[model samples]
Target: MELTVSPAPHIHDNLTVSKCMYNVIIALLPAFAVSLYFFGIGALIVTLSSILSCVIVEYLIQKYLLKEKPSIGNGSAILTGLLLAFNLPSNLPIWIVVIGSIVAIGIAKMSFGGLGNNLFNPALAGRVFLLISFPTQMTQWPRPIVSRWNYTDTETGATLLSKLKEEGSQWIEQIDIANLWIGNQGGSLGEVGAIALLIGFAYLLYRKIISWHIPVSILLTVFLFSFVLACGQETGNMQNIPMWQYAFDFALIQLLSGGLLLGAIYMATDYVTSPMTSKGMIIYGIGIGILTVVIRQWGGYPEGVSFAILIMNAFTPLINNYIKPKRFGNHRS
Candidate 1:
C-alpha cells in the first residue's frame, strides 16, 4: 500500500473564489435594479463604465505591469466596479468613474497583492478618493425619477443627512420614511434604496455567502446609539407623537437613511478586510457603527460609512491578533 502525505485534513467543499464573487453580484442585482429605476440612463452608464474600467485596469495591471496571467475571469474586478459605482452619484462623469475604477483596481487591489491581500475595501477606497478629489461632483446627488434622463444636467438636491445638518432636527418631521425605504429619495445610487439593499442582504444570508454577525451588529449598534442621541436631544414634538416614539423614529431614520444599510450589509462585510472570528466581527462592526454615527453627527462629512468601514479595515489585523480564534478539534490538556 502506498501512503500519500499532504497538508492537514484537506477537506474541501465546492465553494470557490469565483462562486463567492458571483454570489455577491447576484445579491447586488436588486439594488442595481433600484438604481436604474430611480437614476435611469445615468445609472446604466456609470455602472457599465465602472465595471469595464475595473476589469480592463486589473487585466492590464496583471498582464503588463505584474508580468502575470490576468485573473479577470474570477469576477473580483466586476464586483469591485459594481460596488464602486454603487458608492458614486449617478450623474458623475464617465471620466471620473473610469478614474475611480483605476484607483479601486490598480491602487487599492493589485498594488496590495490583489484581491485577498488588500487591507482596505477597494470600492470604498476609490469612492473616498473621488470624494476628496472631486468634492462638488461627488456631493451633487440628482433628484430621483425626475432627473433620471438628464445625466450631467440632472437637477440635484441635498441628502437627508445634509438636510438634517443644514436645517436642524425640524426637517426630520417632513421626511417621508416610506419614501426613504422605497428608493424615492435623493441620494447616491445605493443610498436611496434601503428596501432593495435589505432584500440583497437577505439573499446573501440565505445563500450562506456571509454570516449575520457583522451586518446585524453594525445595524444594532447604530440603532441603539442613535436612539440614545435622539433621547438626549430636546426637539419639539412637531408631529405630536410621544417622545419615545419620536426617539424610535429618529433611530429608524438613521438606520434606513443614506448609505447605512448599504455599508453595513455589503461593504463592511467584505471577507478580506473584516475580522475572522465571530467575536472580532462584532467588535469590528461596533467600531464601524460608532464611527459612522459620530461622523454623521459631528464630523464635517454628511456621510461616514465609507470612512468608517475603511478605518475599521485598517484595524482588522490588530483585532485578529487580539481576538484569536480557538483551534479546531480536541486537544489533551
Candidate 2:
C-alpha cells in the first residue's frame, strides 16, 4: 500500500479553474441578455468581437511569444473579454474592441504571466486604456431601444450619471428610476441593466463563487457616502419633496446608475486582484467605494467604478499583508 501526502487543500470538491471561470460566465448571461435587448445588434457585435479577440490574442501570445501551451480552454480569456466589453460603449468600433482585447490579453494578462498573477483586472485595464486612447468614441453611449437595429450609427445620449454630473440636482426628477432599473437608458451594455446584474449577483452568491463581504461592503459604503452628500446639498427644486426623500432617491440612483452594480459584484471581486481574507476584502471594497464617489463627483470622468477597482487592485497586496486570516492548526498560547 502506498500513501500519498499533499499540502493543505487535500480535501477538494468539483471546483476547478475552468469551473470557476465558467460559473462567472454563466452568472454574466442575464446581464448580457439585457444588454442585447437594449442595445441590440451593436451589443452583440461588440461582445463577439471582444471575446474572439481576447481568446485569439491570449492563444497567440502563449503559443508564439511565451512558448507555452495556450490556456484559453480555461475560460479566463473569455471572461476577460466579456468584462471588457461590459465596460465599453456597445457602439465602439470593432477595431477598437480588438485593440482593447489585445491590450487586455497581451499586456495586462499575458504580460503579467497570464491569469491568477495579473496586478489589475485585465478588463478594467483594457477599458481604461481605451477610454484614454479613444475618449470620444468610448463616451458616446448609444441610446437604448432607439438604437436597437443600429451599430456605430446609433443615436447617442448622456447617461444618468453623466446628466447628474453635468446638471446636478435639477435633472434628478427627470430620471425614470423604473426605466433605468429595467435597462431602458443610455450607457455601457452592462451598465444599463441593473436588474440583470443583480440577478447575476444573486446567482454568484447562490453558487458560492463569491463571498458577500466585498459586494455588500461596497454597496453600503457607496450608499452611506452618497446619502451624506445628498442630504447636505441644497438642490433648491425640492418641489415639496422631503429632504430625506431627495437624499434617498439620490443614493438609490448612485446604486443603480452607471457601472456601480456590475463593478461591485463582478470586477472588484476578482480573486487574483482582490484581497484573500474577508476583512481585507471589506477594506478593499470600502476603498473602491470611496474612490468611485470621489472620482464621479470631482474627477474629470463621469464614471469611476473602473478606476476605483483598478486603484484598489493595486493596494490588494498591502491589504492582504496587514489583514491576514489566522493560520490553520495554530492555537493560542
Candidate 3:
C-alpha cells in the first residue's frame, strides 16, 4: 500500500473578521444615535453617504483591480466608512465625505493590500488628508445644536484649542464642562458627546470586541499627566504660570474636550494596526496619551488625538518586536 499523507488540520477561530467589524459597528451605534440626536440629520446624511461610498468603492476595486472576490461583505469597508465619517464635521459637504471615503478605501487601504495589511489607520489617514486639503472646511466647526442652522453661512466658531490659542488661560474659565460632557458643545459631530462615546466604549467592553488595556491606559496616562501639569501650575514655583484657579480648568479642558475620547477608545484600538501583545498595547496607549497632551499643549493643532494615534500606529511594529509574550517554559537566551 502506498503511504498516505495529508495536510495539517486547519483550525478556525470563532471571531471572523466580519464578526469583529460588525461588532465594532454595533458598538458605535450609541454614539451615532447620540450624534444624530444632537447634530440633526446632517450627521446622518454624511454617515450614510460615507458608508455607501466606501462599500461601493471597495466592491469595484476588488472586482476589477485585484481580480478577487469582494470583501465588502466582511464589513471592514463599512467600519472604515463609519470611522471616517465620525472624524468629520457634521457641516462638511457630502462631496467632501465621498472624497474622504475614496482616500480611505482606495488609497490608504487598497493600495497597501487591504484590511489587515495596511500599516496606518485608513480612517485617520483620510481625515488627515482632508484636513490638509480643506483646512477651511475641516477646521470651521459648526455651532452646537442650540444655534440656528443657516445653509449658506459657514461662520467660524472657535474649537477648544482655537479658543486657548487665541485667548490663552482666560478662555477655558468660560467653558461649561457639563455641556462639553453631554455633547452640547461645539466640536466635530461625533466627538462632541463624551457620554455617548463612553456608552459605546462600555458596550465594546461588554462584548469583548476590544480589550481594556489600550483605552484604559491611554485615558489614565492623559489624566495623570494633565493632573501633574495642573499641580505644577498651582505650586511649582513657576511665577509665569497661570493662577491656581485655572488648574482644574486646564485639566478638565484637556479631559472633556475635542476628539480625545473618540480617538482614545475607538481609533487607537484598531485591531490590525495596533500591537498584539498586552505590554505593547499599554506602551502604545501611553505613547499616544503623552503625544496627545504634548501636541495639544504645545503643538500647532488644538486637537491632537488624530495625529497622536497615527504616530503611534507607525510604531506598532517596533513595539511588538520588543514586547513579545513569553512562550510556555521558554527561557531567554
lDDT of 2 by residue, 85-201 (tens): 999898999999999999998899888888888999999999999999999999999988898999999899888899999999988888889987889988888898788999989
Model 2 misplacement above 4 A: 1-8
- Pitting candidate 1 against candidate 3, the one with the higher TM-score is 1
What lDDT does each candidate get?
0.92, 0.92, 0.83
> What residue pairs clash in candidate 3, if any at all?
none
Error of 2 at 154 (Å): 1.2
Rank candidates by lDDT, best first: 2, 1, 3
lDDT tens digits, residues 177-216, model 3? 8887788766776687788888889988988889999998
> Which model scores highest in lDDT?
2
Candidate 2 lDDT at 315 equals 100
Q: TM-score for each prediction?
A: 0.96, 0.97, 0.90
TM-score winner among the candidates? 2
Question: Per-candidate RMSD vs. true structure?
Answer: 1.7, 1.6, 3.6
